[model samples]
Target: MRPTKGKLLGILAATFVGQMALQVGVIQDYWKKNYWSGQGFAESLSPDQTLLQLFGFREFLAGILWVRADSFFDEGNYDAVLPIIRLCTILDPKQIDIYATGMWHIAYNFTDEEQRSDRRYIPSALALGKEGSRQNPNTYELFFETGWIWYHKIDDDYHQSIKWFRQAQERVDMLPARRNLLANAYQRNNQVKEGLEHYWKLYAETAEQYEKQKDIYQLFQQKETLEQNLDTMIVRMVQRGWLAQERGEAGQRVYDTTEPFDVGFSARVIVDEPKVLRVQGTWNVLPVGTRIRIIVRDADNPNFTLAAMDWDGQNEVVLDPERDATFMQDQGFVKNRRFNKRIDMSKDPTMYPFARKSENYLVEFYYNPRSASLHVQDKFGWNGEGMTDKNFLRTDVRKEFEWIPGPKAGMFTEDWKLAERPTPPARIVYTALTLSRDQILRKGDWIDKTPMVQTSNFDASRFSVTTEDIIDVPTLRSSAPSPIAPGEVKKTGDNP
Candidate 1:
């Protein structure tokens, strides 16, 4: 049957619309499988936004949303940024900056009134980063970002971090600075040999690049850092038996980790003035990089303490901004076997309001072997296995991340309890003390004579630190010998 002109035109228009819809569906399905599979299309965007995306304005929409998110961030409207970041990622998953920036904001920017990061957001940040990596698999930035989340934000999960960092390092686009993270992850995971190899390769590459282009001062600077790190690693490795027989090189001293190393770790805090503290301690470790983390906060405030990673993202935990807001934390480097730091909370009234007068204050000192220098870890094995303290010795069993190396370095067993298990990582040794409000805020200056083990006298003046000291690596040797003599055992004196 022959149709009229209007009817024929309408029929053609309908057929065209249907064909277009089918093509759009096919394209979207392809995109969903290959990229932006993080969220369902309808779930992530409104009708108008979806229509805009249909017109190939996905990146445009993403940029606009990211700008809006940045505005929200600048305004301190952090809650509003989360949904925007989610939308932006779904809109344009390939925007590496959005993923990196959004992940950082989610992981670190969401803090409480006390400035402690809301750990609940960490899972979201990690999820977002992983999704971005899935979308942009060829890029190195998102991989690096995800690695950093695990490396730093997720409580020394070097095993987990190394996977992402290694992936990032393999990519040709990875920045030179980002490459160090992979090396660091290797060392932190107790893969000292692998870490040293990576450092040397990276340094050689940087030197070659600098030789090619002498105008790039940053490369030279990078080479210097690489050299320093190399020196430290070499020294630590030699001292700890990791580099025992490097062909033709013998007579190297390797310390025995089976024997306990008495760090003689003791810490005391004295209030020098209103809202000011003098924290002094002796770790008796000769490593220059060992640091004591000191935290001063309201006794009732638990947020000041480092919390384990919350992998359970089923219910997002929100932080209360109003309650327990005052907190101060500083890390003091152990120099000459001693750590001393003057913490003045008098400044930044907004940060350290000291609002709770009636409540007691807690002063904590932490020496996590995970965070200490490799040289320090030579005496105190990872998880403080070989460390002993007379007074403030603590023991706690923590989950160990076991990873199979080679091509499957990142893969882990579904069940952490493997049939043939290695020694369960144990004992996170640290130190702490508490004080009444009167003692912290009102008491005058006084020295705290706490019963702490004092190591045998080692002349610290003979050993001095210098930039050139790195050149004299072999000369350093075990000159700053063990805190306790080989025959002497530290007295744990009957202090219950």
Candidate 2:
């Protein structure tokens, strides 16, 4: 009870030091190394953890509040955003934005990405609005914000966005047409038919969510007059005979060691056949903002694989295009992998290549190179590194096609596109030239002209080709590249 002043002071200092030590290693700093690890802590951390930290349940989380706050804002989880702010102010009362907006509008109505711009925060937002209104009641934004979230960001009741807006001195009036919003989402997704259907549904449901609908019924009915116009004006791509089947030309050629090849063959290989292209590149137009990956490797070179891919909207897509090699900052994952990799990270934005694909793409990276491996992979879709599938050169084209190890699993199909006669049903074909580097180097030196025979996974008894169509394919041979003089090329040492 009778403690000396010096003793009391010492105890206080110790407590302060202890608090700092524990805080230094908090969740915020725990991921300083993973700043750019593509996946951030928030991605895995339960929203509750973020909320507790945001509310100041833990002192160490302060460092990452801004980012965490932004993350919450981006998610438009208004229900959670407000509570966290209330807790935050208890710890740091003067945090202006936290107090001012913690729940102001759910984004105009906050959403997974967009702010419920029209909606305002619940109790807290209302409290602030009340306070703000007293000081500047003439301004309407504060009052309207409350309703914005209720109308749009929540279950999507635009009626509320309008209601609150009306209470304000000035209103945005027209945010987005209720029906048009759905239409826009569909159109943006390239689902025109679906979008049109929804647009009509909206028209039928409400002329305008906020406006009158007496005249809407008459106008919407007129759409029936343009029924024929609903049909797409785009031309159809039609082929005849074998062109319609996978008889050797169904899938896009990843590569073919055949010269104007037929559908089937003995073994899928190049026995001194210079006429056959070693590998062909069949590209896929990747969507924007989505992750993607592609891998091609030798049968023997299992340590690593050489892959080329397109990202619909990563760093590569943002950077200006170049004539030489475009820098691909983003790397995607393979869906299937036998091993697991441990990764450490930091707090920066992880970057990768992202290019919007307007249509089918074609980017050939390697040639009739050698090794013992033959695989193709794309994993961005999966949470893992990526997906991979093993392919082969076969001697039988009529057997059965086995599903490769990864995505789109099925039976293997030998001589998929190089076989003759019996055409398979395919919209496109995928082929790869399976040859060793040593074998290709001896293209004309020690090669044989006899076509190799192979077996296929196809079972005619299983109903030849299914009702489902297959991707069209082609047999392509690589063109010889002109020799480049080494001396003419500049080197790092040459610059010096």
Candidate 3:
């Protein structure tokens, strides 16, 4: 059959347009690899997905996978979502939410029988965030997430968190609230001098924002918080410096080894109703905002926590949703050196099945100085340097603390003399208490009406002085403005 010339021309035009679109997609992908996402397609994508990506279908495919991941999450299929999350991020690397939410799932979703997070996955979560930051160098949210994980989840590694928060603040689009976290990390890391300086800057910035937008309540609130934090830090700095100077003049180190604050950790359990109990405790710290982490779970159940971060899409996803049948957890904050919390495991049978009534339960109480507030850290150091617990005091070697420069004289006159001696070593000192099922449930022969008290008596012999006990404080800025008022202050160690 003879075809018309016009029909043949139309066919040629359609073919040309299709070829141009394909070429444009390829060019766009090339630009994305070199400049946008900072990775090649072959490194992260499967061969089939690579082909799809070349056709500009990466975002679409990533969206579809994200939807599937959400579905899996809703169905309690947490393990299945990891590979999907990985692929989605690789496919559309610019999507920040995937990195944030995916890291959260990996770090927190994998739980044990007692609902304790499988902490082994934390490093993998950190790796994911680091990779995300590499891909999105201009964005601050991923950097902040990385800092948050270190600050909260990675055992309160404030020194590590400071690194990421510093980077996050470098970005121009950083949020004002997130900017304050940098100060918090500094404070927690025992770099109170740096923290105060940062707080002053943030306070001034927020004050400007308040002047510009008087109608916005958040700006005013932020300004107030910064002001309060600055004031508190100043007071603590003055108090600590005075104490240090007094000790030094008495031929002692900056921190006295002879006198240690006794943390009399005690607990009481009162049964309010079936499966409901009031847990109260007192610790001998005169600071507010300290908290104790509490965990109540079946004692006999073995920890069946999986530690793999299988984002390669080749590994099988296996999880047992029934592991958390009897798990309960809470944190009680201290007010006036006392903490009380009520736990009601009566609701949501699916979440708290309490299926193993015959088996004993374990109630765990723990307090870490690294996770405590700055005021607490000021008195106790970052590692319980001035604290003693007779019953639950435990010590272990940790490698997190690093040496920081001693404070030089600046706004305050006392810091220079106090900084002459070394700071306390960030020794891993902690207090912990565990209650058996009989003790908490009032079952078997352990029934008692009196509150259970675990007093830590001081033993002077235990704290013998040693030359190797010297520790380092946080890095102090060479010069800082006075927190009381805005004025140029002399640099530390300057000639008067």
Candidate 4:
């Protein structure tokens, strides 16, 4: 059928226009998704701008903001940089550097600035690191950086640091530096078992690496240092009574207190024919005129004083010829007591009744100057007959000590026994001996001017050492076999 030309032309033009409009919409959507989603584009356009104007430039915008943030950081305008950095992170959430650098600036640089009084800075920095990790869950750097902030910058909380460090460690990309930091954190936190585990792991790995390299000399040095550290840690644990022991052995424990004074006390219960308790340790460094009072009392009844002693530093006489003669003359024959003493319970009859009681006891060492004054006057023949001003300066110390015995089980009256002590791991002792052997061989050559012996053929490698060949005694091992790898020799040497 014949149609009008005007109607046909109108139809064609309308169809072409609609097709163009559809193409324009597709282009706009692509631009928004690929380009305009980031912070730079958002900043470039006005807040009231239409959605079309805000589309398709986010990555470019994020890059621009990152540059500006870096400049702000260099200018010491940390506060100004934070928002920009945060915006950059939001725009490009996968950028690991943004999170690490931003958090570092906030936590370290900002807090270390001259006007560092803003208490909110640290927590805010921590929050930012957390958010960054949340945004990129697979990244280990963010977690490690966050842990570093907690360990070094904020509260020196090893627990929090170790937690995050461990999280980072779970990732395969974790750095060796992070592992070392974790080991240190364990040691500093007094988690000795964990520390030893890490140390031994590191030692084993280092030995394996060094053995392959045939860098035996450096390996010897490294092993020696590690063994020394292990020995020192063991001694410290034993002194602190952290190590387990049998019932008949001495029960030792160390206490750190901050009530009457900042001091540490090591108490040991000697399980002899007549069990005796000994308490002793160094106290806080005090001023010259400071006085300390040591008191033992029944835990259940504080009124019952078991033993008492007064230490007056003012009464101390310096015998050094270099001191002022006049000052020496003024201070009488009473030696200056530094508040370090080993008090024996068996020798003190007054302490026997309290010790025999099933209830626990308390030991207090405090700064009581007035009490010291009274003791000084009586002992030094002053009699306090004419002295009008009896008031003496008193400084309150901030440490208190208390000890309690184990309680009987409820409903069944049986004496509570100490928990079994953990036996030191066999690998630890084996490693120590191996290290000691290397050290001795190295020193023996140096001293006797002999060629270094082939360590592989040494008798110590077979763990066959006579008493005469023993160096320092290796720590006791558990009943379990040593974890030393097969073909790895346990060696010992003469003490050097």
Whose lDDT is greatest here? Answer: 1
Tens-place lDDT per residue, model 1, 1-496, is: 8889999999999999999898797877787665543434555456875565554677798888889988988999988987787677767767889889988987788654435564545767776776677667777888899889888876465677877787778678988887987888877766667788999999999999999999999999999999999998788666554455345343445354445677766665667776677777766665477777666667665333432323324122122233335656567776555666677766555556677754676677666677666556776655565577776666452445544445443322122222222544545556557676656556443234222212234223323322222211223444743343322233332110
Q: TM-score, each model?
A: 0.58, 0.21, 0.56, 0.40
Task: State the lDDT of candidate 2 residue by residue for 134-201, as single tens digits.
Answer: 22334444444444433323322222333334344232332323324434333222233444675455
Clashing pairs in model 3, backbone N/Cα/C closer than 3 A: 390-456
The runs of at least 3 residues in candidate 3 whose Cα sits more than 4 Å from the true structure, single-residue gaps closed, are: 1-55, 209-217, 239-259, 264-367, 373-383, 389-396, 400-423, 430-496
Expressed as tens digits, the lDDT of each residue in 278-392 for candidate 4 is 2222222221232333333334442222222111111211111111100000011111112223333333232133332323344443332212242232211111111111122
Selected candidate, larger TM-score, 1 vs 2: 1
- 54-83 in candidate 3: lDDT tens per residue? 557777888999999999999999879988
User: What is the lDDT for 459 in model 3?
Assistant: 27
Off by over 4 Å in 2: 1-194, 205-496
Provide the lDDT at 123 for model 4.
54
Clash counts per candidate, in order, are 0, 127, 1, 21
Every model: Cα RMSD to truth: 9.9, 23.0, 15.1, 27.5
**Which residue window of length 10 is worst by lDDT in model 4?**
324-333
Cα lDDT over the full model 1: 0.64
